[model samples]
Target: MRSFVTFASAFLVGLISFTNCTKRTSSTATQTGGGMAAEQQLAGDDLTKARANYTNFCGGCHGRSLETFVNRKWQHGDSPEALFKGIKHGYPDQGMPSYDTTFTDQEIRHLVSYIREGIVAQKGKTETKSNAAVLKSEKLNFQLDTVLTGINVPWAMAFLPNGDMLVTERSGTLYRFTKAKQLQKIEGVPEVLAQGQGGLLDVKLHPDFSKNNIIFLSYSAVKRDGGQTLSTTAIMRAKLEGNSLTNQKQIFEAQPYARTRHHYGSRIEFGRDGYLYFSMGDRGGTKVNPQNLSVHAGKTHRIKEDGSIPADNPFVNRQDAMPSIYTFGNRNAQGMALNPTTGDIWLHEHGPKGGDEVNIVKKGANYGWADVTHGIDYNGSKISDLNQKDGITDPIKIWVPSIAPSGMAFVTGDRYSGWKGSLLVGSLSFKFLSRLELDGNKVVREERLLQDIGRVRDVRLSPDGYVYIAVENPGIIYRLVPVSN
Candidate 1:
């Protein structure tokens, strides 16, 4: 297993803390409040067993400390009975599977006890949860500035030669952010599904946007006639004439449209090799999609700028495989960027509970996702028994208890002195920017910036070398400036 410097301390701040584990008792247990049974019986052996159980199953999603439960006010009740019921029945609609048959009532009680006593007790040992203090104490040199505000779920962005930016939202809207900090809704965008995780996603200009004036858009296109409607990620090319888009043409669409609306890996980038590359996630087809090559689901695809499959594509000659498939077995790779020096494709994907991964994508490689993973299922079940097997590429970095990585950009400009070559990865769950300092392809160190900001949806460097970011929740954009040492 690859070892990583975990941000474990960062997870503990801003939550409830306890000094004595023995006084806390679960409602489901036969013990009374602060009684002799609570101190003698439930303190030692039961907690150890509960912690072990949590690590084996729940830790992947909830973290070993049950961080998500600690950080959020529970919609389901916080009582032991409510927690036990939630754990037993599970919430399949919300990606958590039922554990009714998996664990007994006692085990579920143990989990609740662990949450109340073991996990919540670890908070406030430190004075603050603010990342500002974390950054200041670390003495990192950087400055964050708010660029634009009142935007909605800004998903992806691309810069133009004139310093203006084109951005996409998951709600089927497009906007152009000007150098003067003005926002204009671009006209003539296609109708999108805009449901669940679907909608207008990524926006990028053609590599030669200076001459062609072509902009590329990735969105969830709906196929509807009377009642039934299905949606899939599609790439469209349009001509940008001032604030309006003209000559719009869809270039590529992932095949076999599904009804599910999550996990559309729609990041697009132009490789140095002059091929247009885009990612299509597993589309919630975990068992069948990632392993199959005949379908485009859960795969990275490459095509010409005009949407034709590249003849030199990895699976072009395979009769049983889709010709556009450049690589297979990916699980929702939302972050992708070309390394500035190496020209290699670096991608970060969402794993089940804890196994978010960053991998250097190579041609025709299988990135083992339902078959092998470091994460378990949402219901605290194992997705696969093994983390590694033959023929699967291992990620260079894995974020345990997932950060929900989103947009990514390689730092290319000298405006930030020490960060010129680092990779900035946005996080939706943790609401921070992870600066990965790379030694060749391996991540040597990581610095989390702008923590507790809105969920970072996209990170892009402009032509002028300034770092621009899109933040969701209250939707806004911000720029990063270098601080002098």
Candidate 2:
């Protein structure tokens, strides 16, 4: 049996292998392919090992359900032989290290079969689910009404006063879905470094958007320092003026931009206090940023509408702290919403292999990330020995096997019976919507909604009190209209 440490190290190396698989006219292609038929021969224990190998090695980058490759264009050939060669020889130039040294030829063949199986399974699941016009939930029967389509990677959405909708796509575009159901591109959007996991992200309308045509966008901003490209989570405040953004101002930017492209935890929400609160991931600086209050990374920050640091912030008077920081020790927090009943800012962040968490944002509180995590590293290494400490604030809810929670919203009105006060959270990994029934701050019951709904990216309540879900990979926004009882 392969040691866990060895497998984890291989997993780390395999992380970048799937980024680019463009056909290379190289001498490596001349290598003889493995017996592709052997892939189907694996059964029982061999099959189990293949699943473990892929999860421990490939799932982090490729996604758990193999949904990453669902609608993706395979730059390289999708043939079994092509997959075998790619895995065995690897594409080092394209950031994928060859796996020939790590796994036996037979093991690699089994891995290829596992991937192919997942792809086929996912395609079948998607086709069957996508064609279903109506979906049933525990409380109400509703149908998916496609409002807008063809936008790739719809990350976040906000509703305007007059029933218009604003959506931000991760590929650096802001779109306005008018009440007339026309999709119009908003101009004057900022330039974003649309790299891996970094791009135009969350968008939110100002609380007083009716009185003031203001909107906020959270994105990954790029900067060149010392001839090295660096990116960080940033916020842009702008006035929406007739399908155009004007008076655009960069209200905030996370400091010490990182080289790594992923983990730009940019989620924006306005609290009842009218303060702009947004999340910033550790920028892959897991060891340095989350525990360090002096840096903005791995923190939830609070600022005034114009982006000024608030005097009442918990760390405002501290010399060694970033004044805007409201909480610390948070991993990549992607889902944030204000609790309608308690008015508390609730957030959920992605843990490593497991331990996705839902935390209530507290002033100057530490929601321990690397220091006290229930999750282990992607490579099966322990992130922290302690899951809880005295000063660390424990999560309100924790998902052992990470669902990869994304967008979140609290059902406010009676529009959806038996679900008014429930918390609706989108699952990116499982491709479902989770509705959590809350007894005050405690989650009493949990139910899965819109199962296999194409990677639910964002869920928001429309101005007229309807649940709207945004899904990626064919990127369509659907309104969940309840049926009469």
Candidate 3:
């Protein structure tokens, strides 16, 4: 939606000449061999130009890959003539401006061909019709081995020192998948307010879990205030016994609980420096909480392993600020990971309509959520006038049109050939796993793997060096086993 001004400027450039050309009726451009001829005419430089044109003009709303329009119900027809007329005549009432005088008919034809080609490519990339058991990517061939099935809304997962797995469902049930492939429900999970986006969320183990037997769970903790139920992101630390959780203690809770059930960011991770790092969403208090550090929402926090605040936290010296705050102005960060190579914490947060972001957590940094954003509101309104400003840390990567990123992990070791040091991010909206090849902190290339796999809830590199993915909507867990080509 940040591209609205760009689109408006492009439209206004040819607005004065719009009345010069007569509008074409459907019969004027009949479906015939002419369409095919025009499409075939586009190749090489012309095709490249069309792709650039689309990225400039249409990628803001329609997405760069053009996957936003794929499989969705087209209000108007999607035929070549329909697209041609729609582009030339415009649908002003529907927010689609006509580009009648802006582009020549031949250029419009080239655009049509480019769009149709993108549709075909996206379809082919998503649909897996041949050999469902095995999946192939650009660099590696892999197959999915089903790990667990029939779990509902598996939100987060943790691997134990003994090779057992712990998975938390949004419905507040925790299950343990043993090494023998047996599933058993763990007891003593705290009650959660499983409403909207609030529920049981991330699970993490202590760095010395083998000796401490300590694990942490982040969830929406509910409390009644003034006869109304309110919830906030809370972390519970407990000892994991054979099949139960004991010595349960509430370690940290975001202050000023809200009535809104969504945006309880609850991703938990431990840094290499013997400290626990976690995230908190704005809790629908976008305007107030993110910029105001006195409250806990919309922040990355650091604490000692036993829930005590570290003396060296960024805001520890500020009398008015929360002592545990690491970074502030995050919207709703559901994905947090520790970069194995750099020892830096990486986080990804959801944007409103567009402008999903990936940022490296820095001490006392402001990410500029409500104050500055590349995104617009869900109802097509601008959130901020500026996308960047002084003192606000810009994201390392920004995904326009939003991927709804969740569960991030850095691939370490050479378990998968040619994929070492890649960052795997889950796409909840596109239902895919994104493999980002990084050059230091920058994402140089992105490859989409497991396209249309499911609503990917979590992705993690296990202790054994295999990449595991958790997906919802007929929830299932899968291990990505590399296969030799």
Measured by TM-score, the strongest candidate is 2
User: What's the CA RMSD for each of the models?
Assistant: 7.8, 6.6, 10.5
Against the true structure, candidate 2 reaches a TM-score of 0.84
Ranking by TM-score: 2, 1, 3
Task: Report the lDDT tens digits of candidate 1 across residue range 68-167.
Answer: 4444445466666666666666543223445555565566666667777754574533211232322331434655676777755788888889988888
Which of the two, 2 or 3, has more TM-score?
Answer: 2
Q: Cα deviation in Å at residue 78, candidate 1?
A: 18
Once superposed on the true structure, which residue ranges of model 3 sit more than 4 Å away at CA? 1-132
* Candidate 3 TM-score, C-alpha based: 0.75
Q: List ranges where model 1 is wrong by over 4 Å.
A: 1-140
The C-alpha local distance difference test score for the whole of candidate 3 amounts to 0.76
Which tens-of-lDDT digit does each residue in 1-485 have in candidate 3? 01111111111111100012333432323555333234554689998988866654565345456654555445567777777767777654233555554565666788888888888877634322233477888888888888888776799999998899999998799999999999899999999987556778999988888998999999989999899888889999999998899999998988988877667887999988889999888876767889998999888999987789999999999999999999998888888999988999999887765678889999999999889887765323447889899989999888765677888999988878789999999876666899999999999989999877766789999998999989765578888988888
lDDT of each: 0.72, 0.76, 0.76
TM-score of every prediction relative to native: 0.77, 0.84, 0.75
For 25-51, candidate 2 gives per-residue lDDT tens digits of: 223222344444444756899889888
Model 3 RMSD in Å is 10.5
